[model samples]
Target chain A: MHIQATGNVYRAKAVTGIKTVTDILMFGAGGHAAAVSDVIRDIEDFNISGVIDDSPSLQGKCLFGSTVIGGRQQLYMNGLDTMAIFLGIGDNLTRARIARSLGGREFPVLVHPTAHIGTNVSLGEGTVVMPRAIIENGARVGAHCIINNGAVVGHGSVVGDYSHVSGNAVLAGGVNLGERCLIGIGGCVLPNVAIGQDSIVSAGSVANRSAPERHYIMSPGSRIFRRFEK
Target chain B: MHIQATGNVYRAKAVTGIKTVTDILMFGAGGHAAAVSDVIRDIEDFNISGVIDDSPSLQGKCLFGSTVIGGRQQLYMNGLDTMAIFLGIGDNLTRARIARSLGGREFPVLVHPTAHIGTNVSLGEGTVVMPRAIIENGARVGAHCIINNGAVVGHGSVVGDYSHVSGNAVLAGGVNLGERCLIGIGGCVLPNVAIGQDSIVSAGSVANRSAPERHYIMSPGSRIFRRFEK
Candidate 1:
């Protein structure tokens, strides 16, 4: 796999020895991963190493200047380099699967110092908390999660690994989310709501009740999004 | 005029630079000043000599262990030693009034390292940019302001002095606000919305139009709070 240097600062783990050559390996090369790659590139940090994907159409080509570095079997950097990693998989399950496969390796969590973690909270490794996101006190987020830009995780919430909480989404207090979930942009998950794993919450929708694992579309009048006044 | 030896960190600023038998001076001992005093105490980097206020009800009482130093006229610490001064006023006109009253004595601007700032953003002295607040490119924020936690300022936005952008509020591209404006929590101001100074926007409101430079109440429809399965 070839990595075309983009003249940007390489992203490294914040740890002492790892920051010197902050290269980053991408886990998935899909649309969500592409968007995350854009943020990483724009952030003035992190160098993209290469992607590891099993898609036949992408196996031979480069995504974001990094070659598809073959399948899961061929992952790893031949012990020649030290780098951090970001899980670019969309679904939480995919993220969890990939994370377990690579758990022995180091994937430092990336919390943009700009994220607002209120009074007391614990966010685990491989989680990327983006700019302006708010994780209120008593919130617990597991590994390999993406709390995107301007997202809000209200107080006392628990999010399992491989969950992608998109930009401007709000999760009220006591909300519980299972593994491999995707909470889309501008979505609101009400307080005390529980969602099972492998769920896809659509953008701008309001989730008020308990939802089992998998996809649930908000029907008409389920949520209100429009307001116009000075 | 007197430092009462209050133990709280907020009162410690009153004792910062006082040798044996020290006197403290302060200004605008109000709700805003109370919080500002707390931060100053945390700074421990400055000296609070005394206070200056004409409010009759608070004139004789001791705040943070420092007595109101006989109004604005007697604010000068006759023979006391001080490292710096603090402008505890929350109003733009009044804070500026007191700063001008000091004639360049120096009040520190506190910019939290966690605050996200874009290129060409302007901030004034004594302004505190709270954690996770995003000051976008070319945004101008004036003096003695409180850009609170998780607040977002979009590109080309102009925010006036002593303004408080509450938590999780989003000001889309090019929003302009006047002095002493208070934007409520979880509010969103659409692009190019011009709001005058001293304006107050309630929580969970999505403002799409220009507002006068005064208090504006927003009534957002009932939010579903969360999404769940049907």
Candidate 2:
């Protein structure tokens, strides 16, 4: 109400929704971490407050001006609900472990604009779907999941929470993922197969049949080879 | 005139376009065959008239009602323009061999609807992008390429024709792909590396260094490997 200030024009601040200023904790320090950080940066409402990693070399390093903190050796991020934690880990097994350590905390699910998620699809809280991750019609995803970059959750699939479908993994129609399951990088699960929870399907494997709760290591030939060569 | 006589429906033949078919001999018949067959079946334009394979077990099987004619020691579709050949091989090195054998024929490029191709992205004829494949902004994809399921071509990346980026492979920004290159399953190429044409990066490899060609391979830990271990 100051009449003398009429000649001076001030650039107006853009009005935003009431729920602004979301804080986020990123879970990795590698290239994938850097990439996810960029994605979180693109979102207007969220700000990456910090990163959690076990790498001593990166513990004090500045990642886009955020300090890297340590967590449970496996669960490298403190699951404090005051801020949402994102699983920047690309590996499924590690992601599942981290998700469990964060036990029952509210994880904010982030779906990138470029992604195409269809109707009748249920995505759990705290899951992050990168650009081009297509969740087709009739898909059910559980809580605390990580749908990595370019992954495909085909029609009529069920993925439990605390699971990580690695970057580029393809789960064909009607594939059932038990809780905390790990579908490794580029793994292909054919239609109608059920993977038990807490199980790890090795990277590059082609799963056409149901498997129990354990590590199903695949050889270079995409076959069920001997157990993982430690 | 026929509506009353034909059970309340006109029986006139539905007018349809006769798509220009690519005369081709299909090679490989497995999971990749299932996907390629699905595409071929969906696109009535290309008549995938027959299939050829060296596998004794699959030699006589029918793929999507199309019979497997014979082994493809040599290209043979009997000069039918309605058929254009496509390689249904999953792995990269195997496809390279198949590509060499079918040098004279034309392969039509197939792009799935779920793919998000960005601006200034140039894709050559005969390249196929499976579902959820993302060819980002400023990417130039060359001829005879196979950008498999859920693969990512980052912005400003240049992939030469005849190169195959296997399912879920990730190429970072400004990367250069040489001609006839084969990037294996789940491989990740770091930013700004120029991979020489005709080279093969092994599956699960993460290439941080530039790969000079003739022939070269790399593993995930950035160790030197081979394209095909005999």
- Considering just chain B, what TM-score does every model have? 0.65, 0.71
- Count clashing residue pairs in model 2: 9
Instruction: Kindly give the stretch of ten consecutive residues in candidate 2 chain B with the minimal lDDT sum.
Output: B1-10
**What digit string (tens of lDDT, one per residue) describes model 2 on residues B15-113?**
011234444456777787778776665444456677878877877788767778778653544454335667777655577676666666656566665
Summing lDDT over every window of 10 consecutive residues in candidate 2 chain A, give the lowest-scoring window: A1-10
Tens-digit lDDT string for candidate 2 (A1-230) = 00111111110110111233377777787655655554554344577777778777777677745887665353333454455567776556677777777765446666655566776666666566666677877888876677766789999999987787766779999999898887765678999999988887765567878988765745343111121232
Q: Which model scores highest in TM-score? A: 1
User: What is candidate 1's lDDT per residue for B1-230, written digit by digit as tens?
Assistant: 21121112211222222332222245678876676565555545444666667777777778875677666655554553333556666656677666666764544565444555654456665676665566654577776677776687765678887777777677766789888777777766756888876677666665657877665747445666557767
For candidate 2, give the lDDT of residue B123.
65
The candidate maximizing lDDT is 2
Q: For candidate 1, give the lDDT of residue B91.
A: 56
Interface CA RMSD of each prediction in angstroms: 7.7, 9.3
Q: How close is candidate 1 to the true structure, as a TM-score?
A: 0.54
